[model samples]
Target: MNSARCILSENDCKIFQTITDEWHNSINIEECFLTWESKSKCKAQSKTSFLHTLCFHIRGLGLRWGEVLLLTLNGKFDVITLLETGKFCKSTITNAFPDYNIFYQKGGNPHGGVLILIKQYIRVSRIQRDV
Candidate 1:
């Protein structure tokens, strides 16, 4: 086997080339190189063969919970984890996403909390821990 690096353009994108020999000693080369022309095509091909899962981690969901929910709905996230929720009541958080199942851990302080929300259609289990 032999390998070499080729630079595509002014941006200096690199593509690796590999050469292999068959049992008959004939050099057989495959499409191991990702040239600029094929880079976008490869990415398009990958999207169809891949599963798209979106997860979002939000730092603050206190006053911005509505905005966060809007973003989540637009993005169609599979899971969302929120930190510093600034919420003490479980009903308040649960009411935000009626379509999803919510698990929450309230922090010692009024300004710190964590919540995890997953779509109702997804199968998930919650494990509770005291720390």
Candidate 2:
């Protein structure tokens, strides 16, 4: 489900942890996220830079929503693809994330699903793929 796959580097692991830890102490804001990660190698300095996207294989997004929220907020992700989200039905998770629009595809298996989140400000139209 995560077609736009970008591998996280070793340093990204450190930054991810740091951001997650720091988010706990910071106030939550709906608009304008801190781009601390952008200063690192994580972001491309070019003006042609695209949206910040991350594909995370969180086994279950149910219990760890707070953590997910913190990470996404601190990382300043514009789009996120949650892979292997277990046992969630389509439309059951709508409005789960207030600022982001949700799109999901459930699989036959009890423990496999795909959840895509795009920021509300990003104008996106769904397109079908032959895959």
Candidate 3:
């Protein structure tokens, strides 16, 4: 059997080694997260009204534009539940990046954290077009 050799640059190799050496480091990461509720403000637009509160909460969490836009009523409810339980999902990077206004125009793979939100918008547009 032939084995394929993986090639990496010195810096890449160093990074790989660091991660491998610290594979158990994740346990310490949660504590490092900046709790969104604890922060006073972010640069994103703030809508203080009740209907807009959910959107504000998502933005406060540092969720990307796509993820925020994709959020639904149910998703917002889930966020509340998780907060009550002191459990939250780990965030991950996704392919799409939003413009400055925090709106997703189009194109990109959905990271796990952003998938449900993205699906919410896609479903709406599909329905609109079908009408």
Candidate 4:
């Protein structure tokens, strides 16, 4: 019984460790983005190799898809994060930006949501969290 309990505890530790590592990476990415944004002041500068990420508070994507499209093209971004996107129809965003893979989370309120778009060539998986 003790051995079984130890094994379960060990497994839980490993799972939590993985989650911590992912969160750390997320923080690092956010830091990098903020640093870049501060230096560039929201200029459309293309990155060389690796990932070029851009995030925006689009408020409502349905109203600004065209503007986002232009930024994606001009900046040559590999990942784009849109905040407060309101309600999303996956097909609408997907059809508009066929080059990206969409991942989004709707908020409890009508005026809140987040949408992430990763370039098709880059591999990504959405992490699920239980409420």
Candidate 5:
């Protein structure tokens, strides 16, 4: 088991320790190289005049909102988009993120929904489309 332990820097260990139990269990440590690389990419992008966005296809957010919120807050993303929310009403989505401006389009199929969450500081306008 000792040999299987992941070798991480002190700071990386600290960051890893901060991950929520749900996320920790859901993600395998060995498969997370992309996550670390994305962090570096985000840092590099931040130095430039580029905008950062975090998008996820959760499949279902009914029982996994906590885990998703943990990642979103920790990532400090400018925008968050979620798919397959399994939410039929707008109130449910609004209640999840009171601080965010939520826009969603519910599909006719059960357990199918799309949501976009934008932070309060960012200005956004709703565009009406003729369907």
Candidate 6:
């Protein structure tokens, strides 16, 4: 049986170091992405694709995930794309791909903000903090 109060000793670190060293030098971007997906247990392929799109837009244009997800379809262009390209047209927020759902805070709520699903797992710390 495993114990919860287990302390990671130096021997544990040595083993972890050896395991990490095996993949540290050869890991590529695609492999890193796959590893993240596997560790996150985000099995829904649509969710993974959403995260990839979100990460790319976040890194490329420095926009928050909430901003990207809550973008309205009626707008002329997505703010991030427009700000980057200086052109405005019908937004693609709803078209092209509709498999993913956008999360946002509705009016008449105490906490006013959008929620973006960046990962598949919720941290215990977050649950404690919320309560």
Q: Model 6: residues >4 Å from true position, as ranges?
A: 1-8, 11-15, 25-27, 42-131
* Model 4: how far residue 128 lies from native, Å: 1.1
The total number of steric clashes, by the backbone 3 Å criterion, in model 6 comes to: 0
Worst 10 residues of 4 by lDDT: 40-49
Q: What is the lDDT of residue 67 in candidate 1?
A: 74
Better of 3 and 4 by lDDT: 4
**Could you give candidate 3's per-residue lDDT for residues 2-36 as a string of tens digits?**
11115776677776765554545545655324333
Lowest lDDT sum, 10 consecutive residues, model 6, at: 79-88
Best candidate according to lDDT: 4
Instruction: Flag regions of model 3 displaced more than 4 Å.
Output: 1-5, 28-131
lDDT of 3 at 116: 25
Error of 2 at 58 (Å): 0.8
User: For model 6, how does the per-residue alpha-carbon lDDT over 1-131 read when each residue is reduced to its tens digit?
Assistant: 02312555667766666546545754676785677567568566546532122222233212433455455333323112212211112235334324333333332333233323222232322232342
State TM-scores per candidate. Answer: 0.49, 0.51, 0.17, 0.57, 0.54, 0.18
Give model 3's TM-score versus the native structure: 0.17
lDDT of 2: 0.70
lDDT tens per residue, model 2, 31-124: 1145454444354555455789988878787755676667876897789998878765445456556778887888657657888989899998
- Candidate 1 lDDT over 5-83, as tens digits, reads 2334423333222122222343322333433337678888888743234444445566676777687768766677777
TM-score of 4: 0.57
lDDT of 4 by residue, 1-131 (tens): 34545666877767666655555675587775666566565454444347799999987877887888798778978889999898767887888779998888887787689998899999889989998
Q: How many clashing residue pairs, candidate 2?
A: 0
Model 5: lowest-lDDT 10 consecutive positions: 1-10
Backbone clash pairs for candidate 4 read none
| Local distance difference test values of all predictions, in order | 0.61, 0.70, 0.33, 0.79, 0.73, 0.38
Q: RMSD, each candidate, Å? A: 10.5, 19.5, 19.8, 15.7, 18.5, 14.8
Mark the regions of model 4 whose C-alpha exceeds 4 Å error after superposition.
1-48
How high is the lDDT of residue 50 in model 4? 70
Scored by Cα lDDT, where does model 3 land? 0.33
Error of 3 at 55 (Å): 43
lDDT of 5 at 72: 75
